[model samples]
Target: MIGRPLILTTLVVAVLAVAALFVVPRLGGATAEASDLNLEAQPRLGASDAPVQIVVFEDYLCPACGQFAETVFPRLEREFVETGDAALYHKNFVVIGPESERVAHVGECVFREDEAAFWEFKRVAYRSQEGLNERRALDLVSEYLPGVDAEAVRTCAAEDLALEAVRSDVGTAQALGLRGTPSVLVDGSEVTATYAAVRTAVEAALAAR
Candidate 1:
Protein backbone atom coordinates (compact mmCIF):
# COMPACT_ATOMS: atom_id res chain seq x y z
CA MET A 1 0.00 0.00 0.00
CA ILE A 2 2.89 2.43 0.77
CA GLY A 3 4.46 1.59 -2.57
CA ARG A 4 1.11 2.21 -4.32
CA PRO A 5 0.76 5.68 -2.75
CA LEU A 6 4.34 6.54 -3.62
CA ILE A 7 3.76 5.49 -7.21
CA LEU A 8 0.52 7.51 -7.33
CA THR A 9 2.26 10.62 -6.01
CA THR A 10 5.01 10.27 -8.52
CA LEU A 11 2.52 9.89 -11.37
CA VAL A 12 0.55 12.94 -10.22
CA VAL A 13 3.66 15.09 -10.01
CA ALA A 14 4.78 13.99 -13.44
CA VAL A 15 1.39 14.74 -14.94
CA LEU A 16 1.31 18.21 -13.39
CA ALA A 17 4.82 18.99 -14.57
CA VAL A 18 3.99 17.83 -18.07
CA ALA A 19 0.84 19.93 -18.10
CA ALA A 20 2.70 22.99 -16.92
CA LEU A 21 5.31 22.59 -19.59
CA PHE A 22 3.31 21.41 -22.59
CA VAL A 23 -0.37 22.29 -22.03
CA VAL A 24 0.20 25.85 -20.97
CA PRO A 25 2.33 26.71 -23.94
CA ARG A 26 -0.06 24.97 -26.30
CA LEU A 27 -2.95 26.95 -24.88
CA GLY A 28 -1.06 30.18 -25.22
CA GLY A 29 -0.09 29.34 -28.76
CA ALA A 30 -3.72 28.54 -29.58
CA THR A 31 -4.77 31.91 -28.24
CA ALA A 32 -2.20 33.73 -30.30
CA GLU A 33 -3.26 31.75 -33.33
CA ALA A 34 -6.90 32.70 -32.77
CA SER A 35 -6.15 36.41 -32.33
CA ASP A 36 -4.24 36.37 -35.56
CA LEU A 37 -7.14 34.67 -37.33
CA ASN A 38 -10.08 37.02 -36.68
CA LEU A 39 -11.17 39.26 -39.65
CA GLU A 40 -14.31 40.76 -41.27
CA ALA A 41 -14.59 39.05 -44.61
CA GLN A 42 -18.04 37.80 -45.61
CA PRO A 43 -18.74 34.09 -45.29
CA ARG A 44 -20.25 31.28 -47.40
CA LEU A 45 -19.96 33.02 -50.76
CA GLY A 46 -20.46 30.11 -53.11
CA ALA A 47 -23.12 27.45 -53.43
CA SER A 48 -23.86 25.25 -50.42
CA ASP A 49 -22.52 22.36 -52.44
CA ALA A 50 -19.37 24.24 -53.33
CA PRO A 51 -16.31 22.31 -52.16
CA VAL A 52 -14.48 25.28 -50.69
CA GLN A 53 -15.58 26.84 -47.42
CA ILE A 54 -13.83 29.84 -45.94
CA VAL A 55 -14.86 31.62 -42.77
CA VAL A 56 -13.47 35.12 -42.38
CA PHE A 57 -13.56 36.97 -39.08
CA GLU A 58 -12.93 40.70 -39.26
CA ASP A 59 -13.48 43.92 -37.40
CA TYR A 60 -15.16 46.82 -39.18
CA LEU A 61 -12.89 49.41 -37.61
CA CYS A 62 -9.64 47.64 -38.38
CA PRO A 63 -7.75 49.24 -41.30
CA ALA A 64 -6.62 45.84 -42.48
CA CYS A 65 -10.24 44.73 -42.55
CA GLY A 66 -11.08 47.79 -44.61
CA GLN A 67 -8.28 47.02 -47.04
CA PHE A 68 -9.48 43.45 -47.46
CA ALA A 69 -13.02 44.56 -48.09
CA GLU A 70 -12.12 47.33 -50.48
CA THR A 71 -9.44 45.52 -52.39
CA VAL A 72 -9.97 41.80 -52.06
CA PHE A 73 -13.66 41.11 -51.54
CA PRO A 74 -14.78 42.32 -54.94
CA ARG A 75 -12.16 40.26 -56.66
CA LEU A 76 -13.05 37.18 -54.64
CA GLU A 77 -16.72 37.69 -55.34
CA ARG A 78 -16.20 38.03 -59.04
CA GLU A 79 -13.56 35.40 -59.53
CA PHE A 80 -14.27 32.65 -57.01
CA VAL A 81 -17.49 33.20 -55.07
CA GLU A 82 -19.68 34.01 -58.04
CA THR A 83 -18.12 31.29 -60.14
CA GLY A 84 -18.99 28.56 -57.59
CA ASP A 85 -15.34 27.73 -57.10
CA ALA A 86 -15.18 29.02 -53.54
CA ALA A 87 -17.40 30.12 -50.66
CA LEU A 88 -16.63 32.70 -48.00
CA TYR A 89 -18.19 33.39 -44.63
CA HIS A 90 -18.20 36.33 -42.21
CA LYS A 91 -17.79 36.51 -38.48
CA ASN A 92 -17.74 39.92 -36.80
CA PHE A 93 -15.02 40.08 -34.14
CA VAL A 94 -15.94 43.71 -33.40
CA VAL A 95 -12.37 44.81 -32.69
CA ILE A 96 -13.35 48.44 -33.05
CA GLY A 97 -15.23 47.78 -29.79
CA PRO A 98 -18.77 48.97 -29.08
CA GLU A 99 -19.39 50.76 -32.33
CA SER A 100 -18.30 47.76 -34.31
CA GLU A 101 -20.70 45.60 -32.32
CA ARG A 102 -23.53 48.02 -33.11
CA VAL A 103 -22.69 47.98 -36.80
CA ALA A 104 -22.52 44.21 -36.79
CA HIS A 105 -25.94 44.03 -35.19
CA VAL A 106 -27.38 46.37 -37.78
CA GLY A 107 -25.80 44.40 -40.58
CA GLU A 108 -27.28 41.22 -39.18
CA CYS A 109 -30.67 42.88 -39.13
CA VAL A 110 -30.28 43.72 -42.79
CA PHE A 111 -29.23 40.16 -43.47
CA ARG A 112 -32.41 38.82 -41.92
CA GLU A 113 -34.59 40.89 -44.24
CA ASP A 114 -32.82 39.95 -47.45
CA GLU A 115 -29.65 37.91 -47.64
CA ALA A 116 -28.81 39.09 -51.16
CA ALA A 117 -29.22 42.70 -50.14
CA PHE A 118 -27.21 41.97 -47.00
CA TRP A 119 -24.01 41.79 -49.06
CA GLU A 120 -24.83 45.12 -50.68
CA PHE A 121 -25.38 46.75 -47.29
CA LYS A 122 -22.06 45.33 -46.11
CA ARG A 123 -20.33 46.77 -49.17
CA VAL A 124 -21.85 50.18 -48.56
CA ALA A 125 -21.18 50.07 -44.82
CA TYR A 126 -17.51 49.34 -45.33
CA ARG A 127 -17.35 52.08 -47.92
CA SER A 128 -18.91 54.57 -45.55
CA GLN A 129 -16.80 53.62 -42.55
CA GLU A 130 -15.41 57.10 -41.99
CA GLY A 131 -18.83 58.72 -41.73
CA LEU A 132 -20.65 55.90 -40.03
CA ASN A 133 -23.61 56.95 -37.96
CA GLU A 134 -26.16 54.40 -36.80
CA ARG A 135 -29.07 56.47 -38.02
CA ARG A 136 -27.31 56.99 -41.30
CA ALA A 137 -26.61 53.29 -41.46
CA LEU A 138 -30.32 52.68 -41.17
CA ASP A 139 -30.99 55.18 -43.96
CA LEU A 140 -28.28 53.77 -46.17
CA VAL A 141 -29.67 50.32 -45.61
CA SER A 142 -33.05 51.46 -46.88
CA GLU A 143 -31.50 53.06 -49.92
CA TYR A 144 -29.48 50.00 -50.74
CA LEU A 145 -32.05 47.34 -49.91
CA PRO A 146 -35.03 48.66 -51.84
CA GLY A 147 -37.70 46.22 -50.70
CA VAL A 148 -36.60 45.94 -47.07
CA ASP A 149 -38.63 48.03 -44.64
CA ALA A 150 -36.38 50.41 -42.74
CA GLU A 151 -38.54 50.41 -39.63
CA ALA A 152 -38.44 46.63 -39.56
CA VAL A 153 -34.73 46.76 -40.10
CA ARG A 154 -34.34 49.13 -37.20
CA THR A 155 -36.55 47.11 -34.89
CA CYS A 156 -34.95 43.79 -35.70
CA ALA A 157 -31.46 45.17 -35.48
CA ALA A 158 -32.22 46.58 -32.06
CA GLU A 159 -33.90 43.43 -30.86
CA ASP A 160 -33.43 39.69 -30.60
CA LEU A 161 -32.62 38.06 -33.91
CA ALA A 162 -29.90 40.30 -35.25
CA LEU A 163 -28.46 40.86 -31.82
CA GLU A 164 -28.21 37.13 -31.36
CA ALA A 165 -26.58 36.74 -34.74
CA VAL A 166 -23.91 39.30 -33.94
CA ARG A 167 -23.36 37.81 -30.51
CA SER A 168 -23.09 34.39 -32.02
CA ASP A 169 -20.40 35.59 -34.37
CA VAL A 170 -18.53 37.17 -31.52
CA GLY A 171 -18.96 34.05 -29.47
CA THR A 172 -17.56 31.99 -32.31
CA ALA A 173 -14.42 34.12 -32.32
CA GLN A 174 -14.01 33.87 -28.58
CA ALA A 175 -14.52 30.15 -28.70
CA LEU A 176 -11.78 29.93 -31.29
CA GLY A 177 -9.59 32.01 -28.88
CA LEU A 178 -9.17 34.78 -31.45
CA ARG A 179 -8.36 38.25 -30.13
CA GLY A 180 -8.07 40.41 -33.28
CA THR A 181 -9.48 41.03 -36.72
CA PRO A 182 -8.97 39.55 -40.21
CA SER A 183 -9.10 35.85 -39.29
CA VAL A 184 -9.58 33.22 -41.94
CA LEU A 185 -10.50 29.60 -41.29
CA VAL A 186 -9.95 27.05 -44.03
CA ASP A 187 -11.84 23.82 -43.66
CA GLY A 188 -12.32 24.75 -40.03
CA SER A 189 -8.61 25.14 -39.46
CA GLU A 190 -7.18 28.51 -38.50
CA VAL A 191 -4.61 29.81 -41.00
CA THR A 192 -2.96 33.10 -42.00
CA ALA A 193 -4.97 36.32 -42.28
CA THR A 194 -3.93 37.72 -45.67
CA TYR A 195 -6.05 37.65 -48.81
CA ALA A 196 -3.46 35.63 -50.69
CA ALA A 197 -3.10 33.17 -47.84
CA VAL A 198 -6.86 32.91 -47.59
CA ARG A 199 -7.22 32.44 -51.30
CA THR A 200 -4.75 29.62 -51.36
CA ALA A 201 -6.44 27.97 -48.39
CA VAL A 202 -9.80 28.31 -50.07
CA GLU A 203 -8.49 26.77 -53.26
CA ALA A 204 -7.03 23.88 -51.33
CA ALA A 205 -10.29 23.38 -49.47
CA LEU A 206 -12.13 23.43 -52.78
CA ALA A 207 -9.83 20.81 -54.17
CA ALA A 208 -10.26 18.63 -51.13
CA ARG A 209 -13.99 18.86 -50.76
Candidate 2:
Protein backbone atom coordinates (compact mmCIF):
# COMPACT_ATOMS: atom_id res chain seq x y z
CA MET A 1 0.00 0.00 0.00
CA ILE A 2 2.82 2.44 0.84
CA GLY A 3 4.65 1.69 -2.41
CA ARG A 4 1.49 2.22 -4.50
CA PRO A 5 0.80 5.63 -2.88
CA LEU A 6 4.38 6.72 -3.47
CA ILE A 7 4.17 5.66 -7.11
CA LEU A 8 0.94 7.64 -7.60
CA THR A 9 2.51 10.74 -6.04
CA THR A 10 5.54 10.47 -8.34
CA LEU A 11 3.35 10.11 -11.38
CA VAL A 12 1.36 13.18 -10.42
CA VAL A 13 4.53 15.19 -10.01
CA ALA A 14 5.81 14.05 -13.37
CA VAL A 15 2.57 14.99 -15.06
CA LEU A 16 2.58 18.45 -13.53
CA ALA A 17 6.18 19.00 -14.61
CA VAL A 18 5.28 18.07 -18.15
CA ALA A 19 2.25 20.35 -18.02
CA ALA A 20 4.40 23.28 -16.93
CA LEU A 21 6.72 22.67 -19.84
CA PHE A 22 3.83 23.27 -22.21
CA VAL A 23 2.05 25.97 -20.18
CA VAL A 24 4.98 28.21 -19.41
CA PRO A 25 5.96 28.63 -23.03
CA ARG A 26 2.46 29.72 -23.91
CA LEU A 27 2.56 32.21 -21.09
CA GLY A 28 5.52 34.29 -22.34
CA GLY A 29 8.28 31.81 -21.63
CA ALA A 30 9.08 31.19 -25.31
CA THR A 31 10.93 33.87 -27.19
CA ALA A 32 9.86 34.86 -30.67
CA GLU A 33 12.15 34.65 -33.67
CA ALA A 34 14.05 37.88 -34.31
CA SER A 35 14.05 37.43 -38.05
CA ASP A 36 10.26 37.20 -38.11
CA LEU A 37 10.06 40.50 -36.25
CA ASN A 38 11.31 42.45 -39.28
CA LEU A 39 12.67 45.21 -37.09
CA GLU A 40 14.42 46.80 -40.06
CA ALA A 41 12.88 50.01 -41.35
CA GLN A 42 10.64 50.24 -38.29
CA PRO A 43 10.37 53.49 -36.35
CA ARG A 44 12.19 53.22 -33.05
CA LEU A 45 13.05 55.19 -29.93
CA GLY A 46 16.14 55.04 -27.74
CA ALA A 47 19.71 54.05 -28.50
CA SER A 48 20.28 51.51 -31.24
CA ASP A 49 22.34 49.32 -28.97
CA ALA A 50 20.05 49.23 -25.97
CA PRO A 51 20.24 46.01 -24.03
CA VAL A 52 16.49 45.44 -24.06
CA GLN A 53 14.38 45.57 -27.19
CA ILE A 54 10.71 46.48 -26.75
CA VAL A 55 8.34 45.99 -29.64
CA VAL A 56 4.85 47.50 -29.62
CA PHE A 57 2.22 46.32 -32.08
CA GLU A 58 -0.56 48.87 -32.46
CA ASP A 59 -3.42 49.70 -34.76
CA TYR A 60 -4.23 53.34 -35.46
CA LEU A 61 -7.95 52.88 -34.79
CA CYS A 62 -7.58 50.89 -31.57
CA PRO A 63 -8.81 52.90 -28.61
CA ALA A 64 -6.87 50.73 -26.21
CA CYS A 65 -3.73 51.44 -28.20
CA GLY A 66 -4.50 55.16 -27.98
CA GLN A 67 -4.89 54.88 -24.24
CA PHE A 68 -1.57 53.07 -24.09
CA ALA A 69 0.06 55.74 -26.25
CA GLU A 70 -1.33 58.53 -24.09
CA THR A 71 -0.54 56.95 -20.75
CA VAL A 72 1.70 53.88 -20.66
CA PHE A 73 3.97 54.74 -23.60
CA PRO A 74 5.03 58.07 -22.12
CA ARG A 75 6.17 56.35 -18.94
CA LEU A 76 8.11 53.73 -20.92
CA GLU A 77 9.62 56.44 -23.08
CA ARG A 78 10.79 58.30 -20.01
CA GLU A 79 11.90 55.40 -17.85
CA PHE A 80 13.44 53.01 -20.36
CA VAL A 81 13.64 54.56 -23.81
CA GLU A 82 15.06 57.91 -22.81
CA THR A 83 17.54 56.29 -20.46
CA GLY A 84 18.79 53.98 -23.23
CA ASP A 85 17.96 50.91 -21.18
CA ALA A 86 15.55 49.70 -23.83
CA ALA A 87 14.67 50.49 -27.42
CA LEU A 88 10.99 50.79 -28.36
CA TYR A 89 10.02 49.79 -31.89
CA HIS A 90 6.61 50.48 -33.37
CA LYS A 91 4.80 48.06 -35.68
CA ASN A 92 1.33 48.33 -37.14
CA PHE A 93 -1.14 45.46 -36.67
CA VAL A 94 -3.86 47.24 -38.69
CA VAL A 95 -6.76 45.15 -37.37
CA ILE A 96 -9.42 47.82 -37.75
CA GLY A 97 -10.28 48.58 -41.39
CA PRO A 98 -9.14 50.24 -44.57
CA GLU A 99 -9.01 53.63 -42.87
CA SER A 100 -6.60 52.26 -40.30
CA GLU A 101 -4.34 51.05 -43.08
CA ARG A 102 -4.49 54.44 -44.72
CA VAL A 103 -3.55 56.13 -41.46
CA ALA A 104 -0.69 53.69 -41.06
CA HIS A 105 0.50 54.54 -44.57
CA VAL A 106 0.35 58.23 -43.73
CA GLY A 107 2.31 57.54 -40.59
CA GLU A 108 4.98 55.72 -42.58
CA CYS A 109 5.09 58.62 -44.98
CA VAL A 110 5.62 60.98 -42.06
CA PHE A 111 8.38 58.75 -40.81
CA ARG A 112 10.03 58.84 -44.19
CA GLU A 113 9.81 62.61 -44.26
CA ASP A 114 10.97 63.21 -40.66
CA GLU A 115 11.39 60.56 -38.04
CA ALA A 116 10.94 63.05 -35.25
CA ALA A 117 7.72 64.36 -36.72
CA PHE A 118 6.32 60.85 -36.91
CA TRP A 119 5.99 60.72 -33.13
CA GLU A 120 4.13 64.01 -33.16
CA PHE A 121 1.86 62.75 -35.89
CA LYS A 122 1.12 59.69 -33.77
CA ARG A 123 0.09 61.88 -30.86
CA VAL A 124 -2.16 64.00 -33.07
CA ALA A 125 -3.63 60.95 -34.74
CA TYR A 126 -4.61 59.38 -31.42
CA ARG A 127 -5.94 62.65 -30.04
CA SER A 128 -8.07 63.20 -33.13
CA GLN A 129 -9.14 59.58 -33.40
CA GLU A 130 -12.83 60.30 -32.98
CA GLY A 131 -14.72 60.14 -36.29
CA LEU A 132 -11.40 59.84 -38.11
CA ASN A 133 -11.43 59.25 -41.85
CA GLU A 134 -8.88 59.50 -44.61
CA ARG A 135 -9.59 63.19 -45.22
CA ARG A 136 -9.69 64.07 -41.54
CA ALA A 137 -6.51 62.13 -40.90
CA LEU A 138 -4.68 63.98 -43.65
CA ASP A 139 -6.06 67.33 -42.47
CA LEU A 140 -5.00 66.65 -38.89
CA VAL A 141 -1.54 65.63 -40.06
CA SER A 142 -1.25 68.85 -42.01
CA GLU A 143 -2.56 70.98 -39.17
CA TYR A 144 -0.46 69.49 -36.38
CA LEU A 145 2.75 68.08 -37.84
CA PRO A 146 4.39 71.24 -39.09
CA GLY A 147 7.75 69.67 -39.76
CA VAL A 148 6.26 66.97 -41.96
CA ASP A 149 5.68 67.61 -45.65
CA ALA A 150 1.91 67.28 -45.44
CA GLU A 151 1.45 67.35 -49.21
CA ALA A 152 3.99 64.59 -49.67
CA VAL A 153 2.40 62.47 -46.97
CA ARG A 154 -1.00 63.04 -48.54
CA THR A 155 0.26 61.87 -51.91
CA CYS A 156 1.94 58.83 -50.35
CA ALA A 157 -1.21 57.67 -48.64
CA ALA A 158 -3.42 58.44 -51.64
CA GLU A 159 -1.16 56.49 -53.95
CA ASP A 160 -0.59 53.74 -51.36
CA LEU A 161 3.13 54.28 -51.57
CA ALA A 162 3.62 52.99 -48.04
CA LEU A 163 1.24 50.09 -48.23
CA GLU A 164 3.95 47.47 -48.47
CA ALA A 165 5.67 48.72 -45.35
CA VAL A 166 2.42 48.75 -43.39
CA ARG A 167 1.56 45.28 -44.60
CA SER A 168 4.97 44.00 -43.65
CA ASP A 169 4.43 45.21 -40.12
CA VAL A 170 1.05 43.49 -40.02
CA GLY A 171 2.65 40.27 -41.19
CA THR A 172 5.32 40.57 -38.54
CA ALA A 173 2.69 40.99 -35.83
CA GLN A 174 0.80 37.94 -37.08
CA ALA A 175 3.95 35.88 -37.28
CA LEU A 176 4.58 36.62 -33.62
CA GLY A 177 1.05 35.31 -32.80
CA LEU A 178 -0.14 38.64 -31.49
CA ARG A 179 -3.94 38.60 -31.41
CA GLY A 180 -4.69 42.16 -30.40
CA THR A 181 -3.53 45.72 -30.56
CA PRO A 182 -1.26 47.21 -27.88
CA SER A 183 0.77 44.01 -27.61
CA VAL A 184 4.08 44.63 -25.88
CA LEU A 185 7.15 42.48 -26.23
CA VAL A 186 10.35 42.81 -24.27
CA ASP A 187 13.43 41.01 -25.45
CA GLY A 188 11.15 39.12 -27.87
CA SER A 189 8.84 37.81 -25.14
CA GLU A 190 5.27 39.05 -25.00
CA VAL A 191 4.09 40.70 -21.81
CA THR A 192 0.89 42.14 -20.43
CA ALA A 193 0.00 45.40 -22.14
CA THR A 194 0.42 47.83 -19.27
CA TYR A 195 3.05 50.19 -18.00
CA ALA A 196 3.64 48.26 -14.80
CA ALA A 197 3.96 44.96 -16.64
CA VAL A 198 6.17 46.48 -19.33
CA ARG A 199 8.41 48.16 -16.77
CA THR A 200 8.85 44.90 -14.92
CA ALA A 201 9.61 43.07 -18.15
CA VAL A 202 12.16 45.66 -19.16
CA GLU A 203 13.84 45.48 -15.79
CA ALA A 204 13.93 41.71 -15.96
CA ALA A 205 15.30 41.76 -19.49
CA LEU A 206 17.96 44.24 -18.43
CA ALA A 207 18.89 42.03 -15.51
CA ALA A 208 19.05 38.97 -17.73
CA ARG A 209 21.43 40.74 -20.07
Candidate 3:
Protein backbone atom coordinates (compact mmCIF):
# COMPACT_ATOMS: atom_id res chain seq x y z
CA MET A 1 0.00 0.00 0.00
CA ILE A 2 1.29 3.47 -0.85
CA GLY A 3 0.99 5.99 1.92
CA ARG A 4 -0.36 9.46 1.42
CA PRO A 5 2.42 11.76 0.22
CA LEU A 6 3.30 13.13 3.66
CA ILE A 7 3.24 9.81 5.42
CA LEU A 8 4.99 8.16 2.51
CA THR A 9 7.93 10.47 2.85
CA THR A 10 8.00 10.27 6.64
CA LEU A 11 7.86 6.50 6.68
CA VAL A 12 10.45 6.13 4.00
CA VAL A 13 13.23 6.97 6.44
CA ALA A 14 11.65 5.16 9.37
CA VAL A 15 11.40 1.78 7.71
CA LEU A 16 8.18 0.70 9.39
CA ALA A 17 5.44 -0.07 6.94
CA VAL A 18 5.38 -1.78 3.51
CA ALA A 19 4.51 -1.09 -0.12
CA ALA A 20 2.80 -3.01 -2.95
CA LEU A 21 4.04 -4.49 -6.23
CA PHE A 22 2.57 -6.13 -9.36
CA VAL A 23 4.54 -8.28 -11.80
CA VAL A 24 3.46 -10.08 -14.93
CA PRO A 25 4.95 -13.46 -15.57
CA ARG A 26 6.58 -13.93 -18.94
CA LEU A 27 5.94 -17.68 -19.24
CA GLY A 28 4.02 -19.02 -16.23
CA GLY A 29 1.43 -18.08 -13.58
CA ALA A 30 -1.22 -15.62 -14.79
CA THR A 31 0.06 -14.06 -17.95
CA ALA A 32 -0.82 -12.52 -21.32
CA GLU A 33 -2.14 -15.81 -22.74
CA ALA A 34 -5.87 -16.48 -22.76
CA SER A 35 -5.18 -19.94 -21.38
CA ASP A 36 -3.51 -18.62 -18.21
CA LEU A 37 -6.65 -18.26 -16.14
CA ASN A 38 -4.88 -19.40 -13.04
CA LEU A 39 -7.23 -18.88 -10.09
CA GLU A 40 -4.97 -20.76 -7.70
CA ALA A 41 -3.29 -17.57 -6.44
CA GLN A 42 -6.41 -16.12 -4.87
CA PRO A 43 -9.61 -18.22 -5.00
CA ARG A 44 -12.00 -16.37 -2.73
CA LEU A 45 -13.53 -14.07 -5.31
CA GLY A 46 -14.16 -14.19 -9.05
CA ALA A 47 -14.76 -16.92 -11.62
CA SER A 48 -12.04 -18.68 -13.55
CA ASP A 49 -14.11 -18.48 -16.70
CA ALA A 50 -15.09 -14.86 -16.23
CA PRO A 51 -14.37 -12.43 -19.00
CA VAL A 52 -12.49 -9.90 -16.88
CA GLN A 53 -9.54 -10.86 -14.73
CA ILE A 54 -8.20 -8.31 -12.20
CA VAL A 55 -4.84 -8.98 -10.66
CA VAL A 56 -4.00 -6.81 -7.65
CA PHE A 57 -0.65 -6.12 -6.00
CA GLU A 58 -1.19 -5.17 -2.35
CA ASP A 59 0.75 -4.84 0.85
CA TYR A 60 -1.02 -5.42 4.15
CA LEU A 61 0.69 -2.43 5.72
CA CYS A 62 -0.02 0.08 3.00
CA PRO A 63 -2.67 2.62 3.99
CA ALA A 64 -3.66 3.27 0.40
CA CYS A 65 -4.27 -0.43 0.19
CA GLY A 66 -6.60 -0.03 3.13
CA GLN A 67 -8.47 2.53 1.10
CA PHE A 68 -8.91 0.04 -1.71
CA ALA A 69 -10.03 -2.63 0.70
CA GLU A 70 -12.62 -0.29 2.10
CA THR A 71 -13.85 1.46 -1.02
CA VAL A 72 -12.83 -0.03 -4.35
CA PHE A 73 -12.61 -3.70 -3.46
CA PRO A 74 -16.10 -3.93 -2.02
CA ARG A 75 -17.60 -2.25 -5.04
CA LEU A 76 -15.70 -4.55 -7.38
CA GLU A 77 -16.75 -7.57 -5.38
CA ARG A 78 -20.39 -6.60 -5.40
CA GLU A 79 -20.60 -5.40 -8.97
CA PHE A 80 -18.33 -7.76 -10.88
CA VAL A 81 -16.68 -10.51 -8.90
CA GLU A 82 -19.77 -11.67 -7.06
CA THR A 83 -21.74 -11.59 -10.27
CA GLY A 84 -19.06 -13.64 -12.04
CA ASP A 85 -18.20 -10.99 -14.62
CA ALA A 86 -14.73 -10.60 -13.15
CA ALA A 87 -12.26 -12.53 -11.09
CA LEU A 88 -9.90 -10.79 -8.63
CA TYR A 89 -6.55 -12.39 -7.98
CA HIS A 90 -4.56 -11.27 -4.91
CA LYS A 91 -0.78 -11.44 -4.91
CA ASN A 92 1.57 -10.36 -2.17
CA PHE A 93 4.23 -7.79 -3.11
CA VAL A 94 6.14 -6.97 0.00
CA VAL A 95 7.52 -3.45 -0.22
CA ILE A 96 7.27 -2.47 3.42
CA GLY A 97 9.77 -4.41 5.53
CA PRO A 98 10.22 -7.59 7.52
CA GLU A 99 7.07 -6.68 9.39
CA SER A 100 5.23 -6.59 6.10
CA GLU A 101 6.49 -10.06 5.35
CA ARG A 102 5.39 -11.19 8.80
CA VAL A 103 1.84 -10.04 8.25
CA ALA A 104 1.81 -11.85 4.92
CA HIS A 105 3.14 -14.98 6.57
CA VAL A 106 0.30 -14.83 9.03
CA GLY A 107 -2.05 -14.63 6.09
CA GLU A 108 -0.52 -17.71 4.52
CA CYS A 109 -0.66 -19.54 7.80
CA VAL A 110 -4.29 -18.59 8.16
CA PHE A 111 -4.91 -19.78 4.61
CA ARG A 112 -3.29 -23.13 5.25
CA GLU A 113 -5.09 -23.62 8.54
CA ASP A 114 -8.47 -22.28 7.42
CA GLU A 115 -9.34 -20.89 4.03
CA ALA A 116 -12.26 -18.77 5.23
CA ALA A 117 -10.17 -17.32 8.01
CA PHE A 118 -7.51 -16.17 5.61
CA TRP A 119 -9.84 -13.58 4.14
CA GLU A 120 -10.88 -12.57 7.61
CA PHE A 121 -7.26 -12.04 8.50
CA LYS A 122 -6.83 -9.86 5.46
CA ARG A 123 -9.77 -7.73 6.53
CA VAL A 124 -8.44 -7.39 10.02
CA ALA A 125 -4.98 -6.56 8.79
CA TYR A 126 -6.35 -3.69 6.76
CA ARG A 127 -8.67 -2.55 9.49
CA SER A 128 -5.88 -2.44 12.05
CA GLN A 129 -3.32 -0.89 9.76
CA GLU A 130 -3.59 2.62 11.10
CA GLY A 131 -0.73 3.82 13.36
CA LEU A 132 0.97 0.43 13.53
CA ASN A 133 4.19 -1.07 12.26
CA GLU A 134 4.91 -4.64 11.16
CA ARG A 135 5.44 -6.09 14.63
CA ARG A 136 2.32 -4.52 16.01
CA ALA A 137 0.37 -5.53 12.93
CA LEU A 138 1.54 -9.08 13.26
CA ASP A 139 0.35 -9.08 16.85
CA LEU A 140 -3.14 -8.14 15.75
CA VAL A 141 -3.53 -11.26 13.59
CA SER A 142 -5.07 -13.15 16.49
CA GLU A 143 -7.95 -10.75 16.85
CA TYR A 144 -9.47 -11.76 13.52
CA LEU A 145 -8.44 -15.37 13.34
CA PRO A 146 -11.10 -17.00 15.47
CA GLY A 147 -10.05 -20.11 17.31
CA VAL A 148 -6.51 -19.83 16.07
CA ASP A 149 -3.67 -20.43 18.47
CA ALA A 150 -2.16 -17.01 18.86
CA GLU A 151 1.23 -18.30 19.91
CA ALA A 152 1.38 -20.66 17.00
CA VAL A 153 0.34 -17.97 14.56
CA ARG A 154 3.02 -15.62 15.87
CA THR A 155 5.67 -18.31 15.69
CA CYS A 156 4.73 -19.35 12.19
CA ALA A 157 4.58 -15.76 11.03
CA ALA A 158 8.21 -15.35 12.03
CA GLU A 159 9.39 -18.48 10.22
CA ASP A 160 10.75 -18.91 6.71
CA LEU A 161 8.03 -21.23 5.46
CA ALA A 162 5.36 -18.58 5.83
CA LEU A 163 7.67 -15.77 4.67
CA GLU A 164 8.57 -17.57 1.45
CA ALA A 165 5.11 -17.00 0.01
CA VAL A 166 5.57 -13.27 0.54
CA ARG A 167 9.06 -13.36 -1.01
CA SER A 168 7.74 -15.13 -4.07
CA ASP A 169 5.06 -12.48 -4.47
CA VAL A 170 7.71 -9.75 -4.28
CA GLY A 171 9.65 -11.52 -7.01
CA THR A 172 6.52 -11.66 -9.12
CA ALA A 173 5.83 -7.97 -8.59
CA GLN A 174 9.40 -6.99 -9.50
CA ALA A 175 9.11 -8.96 -12.71
CA LEU A 176 5.91 -7.12 -13.57
CA GLY A 177 7.55 -3.71 -13.00
CA LEU A 178 4.93 -2.71 -10.48
CA ARG A 179 5.82 0.73 -9.14
CA GLY A 180 3.34 1.19 -6.31
CA THR A 181 0.51 -0.06 -4.19
CA PRO A 182 -2.97 -1.00 -5.48
CA SER A 183 -1.69 -1.44 -8.99
CA VAL A 184 -4.07 -3.47 -11.10
CA LEU A 185 -4.04 -5.35 -14.37
CA VAL A 186 -7.25 -5.86 -16.26
CA ASP A 187 -7.04 -8.87 -18.53
CA GLY A 188 -3.43 -8.37 -19.67
CA SER A 189 -3.10 -4.59 -19.39
CA GLU A 190 -2.04 -2.48 -16.42
CA VAL A 191 -4.41 0.46 -16.17
CA THR A 192 -5.97 0.30 -12.74
CA ALA A 193 -4.18 2.94 -10.71
CA THR A 194 -7.16 5.04 -9.67
CA TYR A 195 -10.63 4.11 -8.48
CA ALA A 196 -12.37 5.70 -11.46
CA ALA A 197 -9.94 4.19 -13.93
CA VAL A 198 -10.20 0.73 -12.37
CA ARG A 199 -13.98 0.79 -12.39
CA THR A 200 -14.07 1.86 -15.99
CA ALA A 201 -11.47 -0.71 -16.96
CA VAL A 202 -13.25 -3.54 -15.16
CA GLU A 203 -16.61 -2.64 -16.64
CA ALA A 204 -15.17 -2.46 -20.10
CA ALA A 205 -13.41 -5.76 -19.70
CA LEU A 206 -16.63 -7.41 -18.55
CA ALA A 207 -18.73 -5.81 -21.25
CA ALA A 208 -16.31 -6.86 -23.95
CA ARG A 209 -16.39 -10.46 -22.85
lDDT at 142, model 3? 60
Index of the highest-lDDT prediction: 2
Displacement of the residue 116 alpha carbon in candidate 1, Å: 0.5
Give the per-residue lDDT of model 2 (tens digit) for 132-192.
7778888988899877789999888888888899999888777777878988888888898
lDDT of each: 0.73, 0.85, 0.70
TM-score of 1: 0.75
TM-score per prediction, in order, is 0.75, 0.85, 0.74
Off by over 4 Å in 3: 1-39, 131-135, 147-152
Ranking by lDDT: 2, 1, 3
TM-score of 3: 0.74
Q: How far is candidate 2 from the true structure (C-alpha RMSD, Å)?
A: 4.5
Residue-by-residue lDDT tens digits, candidate 3, 45-130? 65677788887778888888889888888887788888878887777877777677767777776766666667777778888887
Task: Note the clash tally of each candidate.
Answer: 19, 0, 6
RMSD value for candidate 1: 7.9
Count backbone clashes in candidate 2. Answer: 0
